[model samples]
Target: MVLHVFHGAGYERERVYAARVMFEEFLGLEIALHAGQEAGWRIVRGEEEDGKELRLADVLFRTPQGEWLTEKAMPSRPVPRWHTGGHPVKAPLVAPDVPVLYGEEVPNGGYLAVWDGGLQIGADLLGGAFWMLTRYEEIVRKERDVRGRYPAFASLAVQEHFYERPVVNEYLEILWWALRALWPDLERKKRRFTPRLSHDVDWPLMGAGRPFFQTVKRAAGDALRRRSAQAAVRRLGGWWRAAAHGDYDGDPYNTFDHLMEWSEQQGLRSAFYLIADHSGAGEVDGDYSLEEPWVRRLMRRIKERGHEIGLHPSYETYRDPRRLRREFDRLRLVCAEEGIEQERWGGRQHFLRWEAPGTWQAWEEAGLDYDSTLSFAERPGFRCGVCYEYPVFNLLTGEELKLRERPLIVMEQTVLHRQYLGLDPWEAWVLIDRLRTRCRLFDGEFSMLWHNSQLVDQGETDLYRRLVETM
Candidate 1:
C-alpha cells in the first residue's frame, strides 16, 4: 500500500523524516509525502496498479513549527500540560487509555477523529513522533549531571512522568488505527516481541581491573563494614589468584559462564560490549585490557558459545570522533586476530554518555552498524520514547544515517541501584513486567543491560535469573 501524505509548507525535511518514521519505519508501509498542498486536507491511500483509493479529509492537526525557533524550543516549567495523559486511542493492539505527547488536545475522546469526510486527525502524530525520536529536547536543553551526561529528571519524558511509557509507539498506533479505519484490509508489517539481552563488560574481572589500593580498600570494607570474614577472604583470594596465576575467572565479577549458561537455557545469545580503550576511562570505568590473556580467553569462550562481542567505547569517547575511531579499530583488530568474524559491529557508550547526532555520527563514520546507548543512566525507561529499533536521522544534518538505535528499555542498575528507581526485587519485577508488557503490546523489541559485576551479589543473581526466565 502506498500512502500519499499531503501537507502544507514549513519543515519539509523534518516532515519527511517524521513521516518515514511514522509510516515506513514504524508501521512498515510505503509512503510518499506530497507537499505544497493544504496540510489541513486529506491523506489518500491507494493501490498503485489498480488506482483504487480511500481518503481521510480535513486534517486538523498542526505542529507548532514556530516552537523550533532556537529561543522557544525548550519545554515550559509546567511540562505535563504539554503532554497528553491517559489519552484514548483506537488501536486494537494497545489499551484504550494510552499516553501521548506534545500535540494539542481536542475535545473529542479519541486522539484523532476517524472521520469519512471531516478532519481525520487533530493530533500532531508526525510532529510529536519527530520531536521525541530525534531527541530535540536534549539538544535544546543543556542541563547535565556531574558526569556530563543528560540527567533523566530534566527530560520531557521524566518531567511529565511518562518515562515508563513508549509514547511514540502510542502515536504510531493512533496513525495505524486511522489508516486501518479507512482501509480495513490494510496489513501492517508483522512483528514479534523479542528479548535482546546485553552485558557491558566494565568489570569483567573485578580483581584484575582495579588498582591494588582500591582492591585492598574494598577488602577492608568487606571485613570491617560487613563484618564478614568469609567475604573478605573470598575477595582477597580473587585478587591473589588473578595476580599470581592469571586466573581471572576466580574474580567475583567473572560471571561470564553464568551469563552464557542462562542465555543458552533461554535459547538466546547475549551481546557483550567490551571496553576497547582506556585513554579517558577513569578508575571507576574499569581498567581491564582487551589484550590480556583473560579477556582474550573470555572473548574466545563467548564466540565459541555463540554469543556476541561488541565495542564499549571508553568513558570520554562519546564526544570525540577520533577517540571513537581508534577504540573501534582496536576492537576490530583484536576480533580479527581471535578469528571472531562478526559481520556487524556495534555497542553502547560507557556510562551511556552520548551527545545526540554527534555520537551517532561518530559511530556511523567508524563503521558501526548500530548503537544501543540511548538510555538515561539515572532512569531506565524509554529515553528515546521508543522500544523499537529504527534507523536514525541527524536533526542537524537533516540526513538519515546507517546507524540504527536499539533503545535500551531496562538497565539492571537503573532499577536495582539505590540512587535510581530504587526498587526491590519484587518492585523491580513489577516495573520491568510493565515495560515488557508494553513492548509486547506493540510487538516491539525489548533491550536490557545487566552488568556482569552486578551478579556477584547473590540476591542480584537470583533477580537476574528471574528476569531472563521471564523474558
Candidate 2:
C-alpha cells in the first residue's frame, strides 16, 4: 500500500529523510513525499476509507524565516525535554514514562490525540527519528574527545540522560501505534530478536609470532601490570608448548575456539573483523599480521567452522578512502587465498573511531555491506538511537547509501576498560542487560563487540557464556 506524506516546504532533504525512515524503513511501507502549504505533516492512504488520514505535527526544522541545517536548527542544550499528550501512550507504543523528544507541548500532552475518524500525533516523531538516524548533532556540534570521536557526553541523548533508551525505536513504535490504529490491515515486515555477535580480532594469539624471550617479557607484563599470575604462567606455558609441539591453546588470548564453540552451540554466526594491514604505530591495524601462518590457519578454521571474516579498517583509514579501499582489497585477497568466501563483508572501525558521513561514505565506496561501529567507546547504549540495521543517509551529500548500519550497541572494552566506563563485571552486565531488554522491546538486533583479546579473564569468559545463553 502507498502512503503519501504531505510535509511542509523547506528542508526537503530533512523532510524526505524523515519520511523515508518512518514510512519505509520503520513501518515497512511504500512511501512518497509531497510538499504542502500546510504547517505540519500528514499521511494519507492511497485508497480512502474511514481510517484514511493520519496527521502528525511538523515541529522540527521549521524555521520562521527561511530554512534549516544552520546553527539554529540544532537541538538546544537540555535537549529532548518531554512534550506529553492528553491521553497516555502506554506500553508497546512507548515504555511507560518515555517522553516525546521533539514536538509541540500542547494541552493534549503532545504525544497523540485519538479522534472519531483517526488519530492526530502531536509529536514530530519522524523529525526526531531523522535527527537521530542521520546523527544531525554530530555534524553541527564540533566537539570531539581526545580520540577524535564525537563524545557521548555531548550527544543530545546522553546530555539529557536518555542514551540507554532507543529513542528512534520508541518514536517508530509510536508511529506504528498510530499507523496500525489508522490502518489495521497494514502489515509490517516481521522481525525477531537477534544477537549480532562480532569479535574484533585486535590481538589474535599470545605467542604465535613472538620469540621465546619476548614471551618471557609478556609474562612479566602479565604479572606486573595486568596483575594476573595465571595469565603470566599461561603465557610462559603457551610459549613453551609452541616451542615443543606448535600448540598455542595455552595462550589465554587464543580464545577463538572458546568464542566459536559458544556461538556454534547457540547456532549463531560470529563475525571476526581482521586487521588487513597496519600503517601506523601503536598496533593500530593489529599486533598480528594477516600474512602470519597461524593467522591464515585461524582464518581457514573460522571459515571451516562457519564463522565470518571481515575487515577491521586501520585507525587512519577512517578519513583515507584510498587506505580503506586498499585494506579491504587486502582482506579480500587474503580471504581468497585462504579459500574463504562470505556472501557479504562488513566490520567495525578499530578503536571505534568514526567521522559520521565521511566514514560511512568511505565504507560505501569500499563496497562493504554494513558497519557495526556507531557506539560510543566511553558509554554503552543506543548511540545511533536504534538497534535495527538501516540503510545510511549521508547528510552532507544529501544522498542515501546502500551500506546499512548495524549499530554497535555494546563493546566489552567500552564498559570494562579502566579509562572508559570502568564498570565491574556485575555492573557491566547490569548495563548491558538493560540495553538488551530495550532492543528486545522492539524486536531489534543487538550488535555486540567482544574482542578475542579481552576474553582472557576466566570471570569475564563465564559472563560471556551466560550472555550467549540469555541472548
The global C-alpha lDDT for each of the candidates, from Candidate 1 onward, is: 0.78, 0.83
For every candidate, C-alpha RMSD to the true structure in Å: 3.5, 2.1
Tens-digit per-residue lDDT, 188-253, candidate 1: 888889999999998786565556787888789878987767667767888888778867677888
For model 2, residues 1-471, the per-residue Cα lDDT tens digits are: 788888888778767877887778876899878997877888888766445688887877586543455568765665644434435554363345554556775445645667776678767887788888888889878999877899988887887788888888887877787778777888987889999899998888776557878788878998999898888887787777888887787777899998899998999999999998886756456578888888998999999999999989888888889999999999999999878888998999988889988999999999999998999998998888998899899988888789999999999888888889888889888988888988998999998999998887777877788899888
Q: Quote each prediction's TM-score.
A: 0.89, 0.94
Quality of model 2 by C-alpha lDDT? 0.83
Look at candidate 1 and give me any clashing residue pairs: 58-119
The residue ranges of model 2 lying beyond 4 angstroms of the native Cα positions read 49-51, 63-67, 80-94, 106-109
Model 1: how far is 94 from its true place, Å?
A: 6.2
Q: Residue 295 of candidate 2: its Cα lDDT? A: 91
